[model samples]
Target: TATGWAQGGIAAAIGADDAPSLHAADTEAAGAGLTDPAVALRVAAEGPRLIDWLVSLGAPFDRDADGALALGLEAAHGRRRIVRAGGDSTGGRVLETLVRAVFATPSIEVVTASVHDLLQDENGAAAGVVCERDGARFRIRARAVVLATGGVGALYASTTNPRGATGRGLALAARAGAVMRDLEFVQFHPTAIAVGADPMPLATEALRGEGARLVDETGAAVMAGIAGGDLAPRDVVARGIFQALARGRTVYLDTRGALGASMPTRFPTVAGLCATAGIDPARQAIPVRPAAHYHMGGIRVDGTCASSVPGLYANGEVASTGLHGANRLASNSLLEALAFSGFIADAFDAMPPAAVLPEIRTARASSDLPAIRAIMERHVGVVRDAAGLQIAVDGLSRLAETGCDAALTALMMAQAALGRCESRGGHWRSDHPHAAPARHTEATLRSPGAAPSEPARTDEALAR
Candidate 1:
């Protein structure tokens, strides 16, 4: 589910003690200097109303006894204004409510299947998706297709996303001639529990907000600016953890002094992980390391969540709405998804139904999936340089050389990542670590055997 691993609560300027401008400023700061100020301002301004709407929909946000909203502070926030539900289980709770609403509505159909490839009509516009369900292949045709398939955290050996977040939507859009952006900005959380889990449990930023400290094996503060440490933006914190690992220092998060008596009630998710790892948070420091968490870049979309392809829509982590910019603020992923889902739904509802979608069956067969996974994890995983990115591009191109449509998606990701020369947000590179003055570029070329040309990266093209 899209909401299972969300540990931090939603960031909003809903608290009386806070204002929207402060929130927007923090957002731009976290986005690594590439955040669109207009988008930041708009989302921040509308956050309170969105939160109220979610509350009305039975989101169960924690509220004070007097009926005021109970807010919690996370990293990068200038105030204690995060809206939470069931403590750290905000994502799960929100997902539960949304799933129920989706199931109850006759307008939405919940299908349990993985989309194998996109189906296109004679005119070359995306018409439907080829999905594999219950070991049988089928096609679901719609006038508009919205991809909320989530992120690529699973491609790494360690992640905090669902197993399906293998950049499936990213590849799908690229192969369909949709414009992609910011493919290089992959965010790595600095405080993932290093328990060797495939998707490591997250040590939420709330722990630091509650006064947790990052220390080494000797219980010494390894990070500078101790008082203002953990609240540093994700990039600084992730790089700090990387440095500690480079020096062979065992990194640990000291929550005993901060979480205190509220461990079980306030953050059940973190408590459960600690119990499973056999580490008592009240008594000992938890082992921690940085791991891939979210993708800042994705299939490019406009305000309406439509992609470059007509009738194709993308939402959630799959769509790059220019909101997160280079880096995403903590807990904003869920908010962005919720806000845009409506944008996509509304746009799709207003469009007419497709008269006759393509019925041509795909001839491609699945093979070497494991090899493709290995290649992505090896070169395109985390740190990247020009040579490594080029190698990844070549490798993905060869995958397309096999004539599999799925491989084209991977090739597009590699090609886009290779073209981005500067580091921004999650897209860090030793070769290009500084932001350069450059106009935004969209990767609109499709995978092999598809369309070709330099499609414009305009809002109109994204809305299709």
Candidate 2:
């Protein structure tokens, strides 16, 4: 669902002068030294192949006059290698293509339900899942389980992600003993349309790539004194706008000088979002602010996309594959997912089945999500200090102890943020005010379930 809502195009190295090495270099630079060089190179190389595969599956990409793929540009990239479809609606098109492929595949069956617990063997290897549908629980047996549930943006009071993006998969994984990494680095997009919407609508960075500018109330550039100006990597741009707002200034994204009347045709999705917000981009500046957009950290996965626990794997925003380190390069999330999916499939095919199996029914804990969101937005947000992080850690940890899934996930993020004392990439600490030696923050659930729980009717089979 997050993939379908994504508006930025995919990044690739298919231009005449472009190379995978160059694209990898750009990605490493943006990641601030935490990105794995080998991972970056390999993922970048797979970009063109994945795009071609999508096309073969009937994805209609925008093309130039000569019939080649029309590549656009985004910030922090040295070349124009962003591949889009239906203008700024690349994600929706890609999702539609994948859905058609899945529907035609007789081997794959789709089930809609809320997965709450992991079924593991006596040896502690993942075996299957326990799902709840219509208030009744069922156990689905499988050799392996892979999670692609997406990021934790909805944990923030203001975000561009759907409400369900609350990191439920993360809670499930953490409880199952998955090692999490870099939980501190959450990317905040600098231009989420501020129209008092519950989940804010995003104004894609591609608009700035196409010549839009960030300006304040008096028409003065908001990012004038910032390096890279309006086109900085997401973190820098977000901090720039955040500091301006902290100083009592209103920030806006002005597209009048750029796309103007052509916006409807060039960026149909954003134009429609603007129309809903009662904004006319051709005549008025779009009111904007930084809001949670992506998570650069997640369940740590190996090169094969397998987690620390056997028989369990992750993909998409739920897995941290070392491709996105401190900060993710623009338009790389979708490409990374496409590339790693192949590795996940290969890993599962070669994995030995667990000899023992068991069933576990879990009753999820409820929490005051509003209170948790307020704590995160007030403390662990765009900028942080030791005191604020401490407050966040204490507050979330309390709720986490009660087995509240949302609070447990938020607690993991807060604990990571609190441990890192330096400012780097997306985790900017106003107190530290400078970058330190780059390192990752990792976490694992120390107790059984963050809290104890009782199920209505429990049935479990244990295997050796």
Candidate 3:
């Protein structure tokens, strides 16, 4: 789990009835970021089925007063597809339901361990995983390995992700030679409660969907002049907040007049979080700042959630299925995870019998995570320039001397971000602050004794 918890409220799962339009939103944001349009579209098209499957698994969903599906951001544009449970604790409720289902299944054995690396067979195919539990290392061999270790948010100082979300799956896959796509595109949530917490608490975008406005300390609307205002795409909203912060203005989510009396009922989770932080949404504006939230890029996978390496699979936030493109639509991640998990299961069932397991031995490398986090926060954050990116690349390269997987992952992202000269989606380059011809970045780990290389940017025309 990314947050060391079964559920994290990072994104909503359901979407509106117009799945094709949602697909277009994804394409517009991703803009040549996806590896395959067909695969991405299939995942989008499966949204309804995935929601139905979750409901069948005992997941409880909430309906609006109109008896319509309550919607989350982006999807909330003109349709209702966002559903919740226990007010704002939708992810928690869904996770609890799934955990119970897993517990009921006798064949499944849940192990508590932190995966450090992947094990490969003599033919270079994935065979198992290397994990550490309670300071003891062990190897778990399997016919098929799924990397769902989650995102790389912990690599940044100001992040809304759990401390455990340090890109372990990405590092393991890259080291094992899986091709990584879009590592440069990391999405920052626009409204993380600015209460000085290590893992910042989120102020869910659903609040804005329900009419809460973003404003500065002067009681001026921060998103006033923007076309969509508070209802803009996440990347746009996040940038708006980032710019406000840059200008020494304190940004806030003002729900007072909009959500006023209904704050606690409509957003119990956020209200609780606000209360803990000594703010009342009903009486005051909740202070907020942008925080590193989600990664739009990861270990690249195909339609079946299969990585480049046979016998290895990835799902959830760990796999860059391209459904999100450069910027992910709100709540689509959960849908993708559920939809692809089914696809992976079917693919696994059709696979040939596994060959004899191979004996493999590997040691986990330790990382100076705090140092890496500081470097990333300083150099590769929401906005980037050539000098800062170069500094980050150099700093991470030096840290790579420790043989740290986390450092390697950071280095990969910095390298890719540095190479892409144009500003697009979450990857904002102050130097090149305009969209260029759309392109996708692809990277592979270097072979021993070979010179390290930057990721290749595939032109949209050539990729298509």
Best by lDDT: 2
Give the runs in model 3 whose Cα sits over 4 Å from its true position. Answer: 2-36, 65-69, 72-76, 353-360, 448-464
lDDT of 2: 0.88
Off by over 4 Å in 2: 448-464
**TM-score for each model:** 0.90, 0.96, 0.90
* Full ranking by TM-score: 2, 3, 1
Question: Candidate 1: worst 10 consecutive residues by lDDT?
Answer: 455-464
RMSD in order of candidates: 4.3, 4.0, 4.4
lDDT of 2 by residue, 225-312 (tens): 7778888899999999999999999999999854867889999999999999889999999999999999999999999889988888
Q: How many backbone clashes does candidate 3 have?
A: 4
Per-model lDDT: 0.75, 0.88, 0.76
Candidate 1 residue lDDT tens string, 1-464: 34766989888898777888888898888887768887777778778888988887888888888988888888878899788988889888888887777788997667788787787776656788998878888888877778878887766666776666667777667657777877667788989999888778898888888888899998888677643487887877887788788789999999885474578888888999989999889888999988878887888888898888877888878788888887899888877877776666677657766546665455444535566667666676556788887786666666655444445555555666677777766766779888787445566652323332222211112211
Best by TM-score: 2
Error of 1 at 19 (Å): 2.7
Instruction: Please give the distance, in angstroms, between residue 448's alpha carbon in candidate 2 and its true position after superposition.
Output: 4.4
